[model samples]
Target: MQRSSTEGPSQYPHCLSSGRTQEAHLIRKGEDMENENKKSIKERVALRNSLVKEALAEFLGTFLLILFGVGSVAQTVLSRGSMGDPLTIHIGFTLAVTMAVYVAGGVSGAHINPAVSLAMCVLGRLSLCKFPVYAVCQFLGAFIGAAAVYGLYYDAFLDYTGGVLTVTGPNATAHIFSSYPGKHLSILNGFIDQVIGTGALLLCILAILDNKNKGAPKGIEPLMIGLIIMVIGVSMGLNCGYPVNPARDLGPRLFTAIAGWGTEVFSAGSHWWWIPVAGPLVGGMVGAVIYVLFIELHHVDPQKTPEEENSMKDKYEMIAMS
Candidate 1:
């Protein structure tokens, strides 16, 4: 009879208490989920912004690259009253590419050229999603840069031995831009040159970018890349125009056609155009494969730790700055 006081209503109160506690726990979990969602959204937004910035950097970098590279050609051609010496063109392009790389290397990896981007993609160094974005930006930048060159050299265009602003004329074809090589060199020869030239160029690029390479100094990647370009230009400019990068040749080549060089741009009468596009791509793949097999696949020296690598990078950066 005395225990009856603890029964009935008290039991109901206990049940209500347990239900309230369960509801509170669920509300807390919901709040946590909301906070987590907010954090994810912020991260996504930040990543999106970063990608946009990188793309813009790429656009600007490529614009400058084409401007200087093709602009140099216009200057030499107009000033000297000739297409200028081939060696001069070679040297001019070499320096131009080097300078562009140095200026934009940090921002956009200094790809500046579509072929380089493509090669990076094939080598697994660059994401496939970024390939089209980089290529399109590079192509547009080339056209704009070419337009700037045309504006600067308007008077020179008039004096050009080739017809000015005409896309399809005999004089314009040879003087203003490249034409299919005469006498029809064997495809094998052209292919060989392109493979060798591009392979060498890609090899140099890999070497410079490899953190494990004792000789590769950080910040000096651009200089080394530039020097390699110069050497290639000097050594192979004549043989195949040494367009080891597809973007270097095609982007500017397309602009040249649009700026009045004409349809002949695609005319590799003997299928020569394929050489430039195919050679560099294949050679780059081969080079990347070789690098992975020979250098990256091998085990790293235990002594060469991340701290050592960082130190090396710092030293290189200091050297570059100096």
Candidate 2:
């Protein structure tokens, strides 16, 4: 009938109960601390400023775009057309646009190109005040991206150029970073080429984003936008490599100007630097006009609710009668 002191739980019920209570208390305390830590982290990690977040997204997006594009050009030129080709550059740009959009679309609408941002501002989709911020971030991103490519291909560049950086020679590597008009290309024609290429770009972009019209599906807009770049490259790239994006061209061009190609990058092609910058800006406006006049304005308004349908019935009847 008597039990030993070391009989365990049966001999010391109260002590066992106390131990269990302590263990439960400690577990609950740990859980509470963990929950508090999680809450603190959740609150601290969120970015509250929309403009700053959007600018960062644009910067990253443009950086990726230029990185892949210029990297492809460097590969092709430095390899003596063995590793890649013009088609390879086109595909590189296409994938670059797609990847950049996927990265930045949710935050900043993925306007990796300043021309697109300018077009959005003109169309009232983006505010005028934010245009400069977006443009600055994009240009900075592209400049840094070009620098990265140059750093990556520094040895190849030296071998190809024999340490001589020229803008208009067989060893010219400046075109690897930016667009250059063909030998026979007139500055006027270069301007026209950019205008048409960028014009088509914005027109298709507007169509792709138009929900009222036959827009791209919810998740694949980025890829469609990419194909537009490829289309432009194949059709309009001959003259000036289809530098449809002002930031895309000028950012890398500025980088080349500073990174040993000298001011000749700006002064070459008959001082052709301004064409890519000004041409795309003008082309964006033109494309917006064309889309608004031809496609967006013609979109038929659809009623979303029963009340809306009823309200629009009378208007439809009147239009039908007219």
The residue pairs in collision within model 2 are none
Candidate 2 at 174: error in angstroms? Answer: 0.4
Q: Give lDDT: candidate 2, residue 46.
A: 78
lDDT of each: 0.70, 0.92
lDDT of 1 at 211: 75
Question: Candidate 1 has what TM-score?
Answer: 0.70
Query: What is the alpha-carbon lDDT for the whole of candidate 2?
Result: 0.92
Model 1 agreement with the true structure over 117-207: per-residue lDDT tens digits: 8778887778989988887777676667767777777766777654455534443432333324435467787778777887888777887
Highest TM-score, which number? 2
Tens digits of per-residue lDDT, candidate 2, 1-322, equal: 8977787768879998999999999999999999999999988997899999999999999999999988999999999999999999999999999999999999999999888999889889999999999999999999999999999999999999999999986788899988888889998888888888889999999999899988999999999999999999888888889888888989999999888999999888899999999999999889988999998888778758988888799889999999
